[model samples]
Target: MTDLATPGSAGLLNGKRLLITGVLSDMSIAFQVARIAQEQGAEIVLTSFGRALPITEEMTRLLPAPAPVIRLDVTRPEDLERLPLEVTRHLGALDGIMHSIAYAPPGALGGRFLDTPWQDAATALHVSAFSLQALTASCADVLEDGASVVGLDFDASLAWPGYDWMGVSKAALEAVARYLALYLAERHIRVNLVAAGMIRTVAARAIPNTDHLETIWRNRPPLSWDVSDPTPPARACILLLSDWLSATTGEILHVDGGLHAVMT
Candidate 1:
């Protein structure tokens, strides 16, 4: 409840209700999305799980308006089952969902692709890739028609030095999004992803050779890429979450400062 300035007039998501997940800190892209969503007049509920719940609750205090933090571990079926009830209690039906959750066990990341065990890889796939479907399905009862589902992504088109299984998971995530978009189309619910460039978030830092990944951005993108700013990608998420992209689904919006388009 740190009362920041509200937007002067109706903003992009004015009067919309949103469910934003994976907001662990101020540096989190999800955190920036929540802040901007509030400025744009969207009512948002954030989700964290287990040990991260308290941290996310603290982060909510930094938003323009007070947002309730709900416990949701996408890997846990019990938590998924309670999601609709929890969302209904807070914001009734949802207009949009920001699925920013992603994780891979240490064994599955950092150049261990060949050495990574099946259990570790499976964990990565479940939490990082499959959670998108699980999350959307869990909230199906609460999501309104024409609702948007936007997930955060890194460019999964190529193999990087240390991304390893997480990269595989991201590739799987893209497929999941496309399938979700196709299925949810019947309900007019748009599902898309924003493939962002590397930013220095806690999760990004955990990956070995992140500097090499950042170096690629610095050298290749026609438009300059800022590793410190989450604003560009966050804004992309906002646009996808808004009705402006009502006709767009099963798409991947690149917010990587033109890097994804470069030949190098």
Candidate 2:
């Protein structure tokens, strides 16, 4: 295994034990973070679900080291209940947890926000927002002192062409993090979100007109963007999970290539 330097000392996450979710493919931001975290000497345990377990297991081998996998379908009560023990069996205690999971039903995207069903919208909010809290609750005991919780998000202050319900989900996710920040602070645990620009992934492919949006980002962003790369945001997640951001909590760190600040 590759060894990383300690936080400001350089090995940022050295000797940390982190739990990462939502790694469906190599293009996933969580996958990249897991890779870099391991390179920096952190031990990682991954979470996946039923049919997707095999895929995530395959992807885990691509990390800097082979990681143990735990089953976690946030939508299921049983899975969440079992996750803690399953993870502990692999790694004694976790120093950090990364929430890279988000989902919405098919009709939640595209140009049909008004046509989207309540069930789908509810699913989005639950998976994208509430699950953060749920995961935190389940993993709280295992979290070492001064632990950190990191989540992936998109800027949700405005509407985007095809993001519809998922945009709503992200906004809710931001608020959820803030609330988690308040509750976990007394325990010396921090919670934060990273608002990243659009990146091509299995999840992004579900959004309609991604190509058109990519073209817009290419011309509009002051810093160039690569839709295929999620490493930038992944690194940002690593910093938040490390001691470098000890005082930072309930905040949104933008890793969008400065797209949020540039004026069209």
Candidate 3:
């Protein structure tokens, strides 16, 4: 029998230097990723700002490796522009980037899809989709050749209830991942998105009618899904960031407990 804790299996992310964003609380997927990455021997830098910074600082103490926090508000141009320099000073170089940042105004979600204004929709697209481009570009110089970029995503093909314009933003995020993969191919940088099941984080719980979505999701997947269990998606992100997925790019790997495949 194989020992699951052997270095080969356990240190899949050994020596990888990554920048992880979007960690708001311990319940977040990004928080789990940061913790697991450190456990697997990876070095990480976390990003946060404003009121969220204090919370993320408290979270850093929970990781095995001490991750330094950086102030990177994706919407702020100064923050984006200075990222490369800051990361260089902090981590020297980046082997991977986990784009966990995404936001949509309340008006853009919670069943306001048809009624959402252009401004709200624009905010969603810009923050949730375009920011990927901005973040990657800002870190391009520091990204080592063969760097892997993974973004958190939800199924954008289906019109999800209560998600509204955020659904459209996720779709745009998918397209952006594809284009980034194509453009970065020359540099040997790979980009992919892990389409995850609805996890009960602060963001998900904020959505209106989420209880209804969660009820259907629990019974729908052939392989059982727990709204609280983030292991599957977090593991998928680690796989993408490691050398194990050297040739996989522009892909959407579903960590949704087979719900997407079985749903009619």
Provide the TM-score for each candidate, comma-separated: 0.96, 0.95, 0.95
Instruction: Give per-residue lDDT, candidate 3, residue 57.
Output: 91
What lDDT tens digits, residue by residue, belong to model 1 across residues 1-264?
Answer: 332337434888888999999898888999999999999889999999888899999998998889998899999999999999999999999999999988888898888889999999999999998999999999998999999999999989988878899999999999999999999999999999999998888889888898898888788899988888888899899999999988999999999989878676
Q: RMSD (Cα, Å) of candidate 1?
A: 2.5
lDDT per model vs. reference: 0.91, 0.89, 0.89
Instruction: Report the C-alpha lDDT of model 2 over 139-248, residue by residue, as the tens digit.
Output: 88788879999999999988998899999999999999999999888988999999988899888888898898788777887898888888889999999998998899
Give lDDT for model 1. Answer: 0.91
List residue ranges in candidate 3 displaced over 4 A: 1-10
User: Highest TM-score, which number?
Assistant: 1
**lDDT leader:** 1
Candidate structures ordered by TM-score, highest first: 1, 3, 2
Task: Judging by TM-score, tell me the better candidate of 1 and 2.
Answer: 1
Tens digit per residue, CA lDDT, model 3, 1-264: 221232224587888899999888777889888888877778899999999999999888877657899999898999999999889998999999999978898999988788899999999999999999999999999999999999999999899888889899999999999999999999999999999998988888878888988887788899889998777798899889989989999999999989889854
Q: Would you list the rank order by lDDT, best first?
A: 1, 3, 2
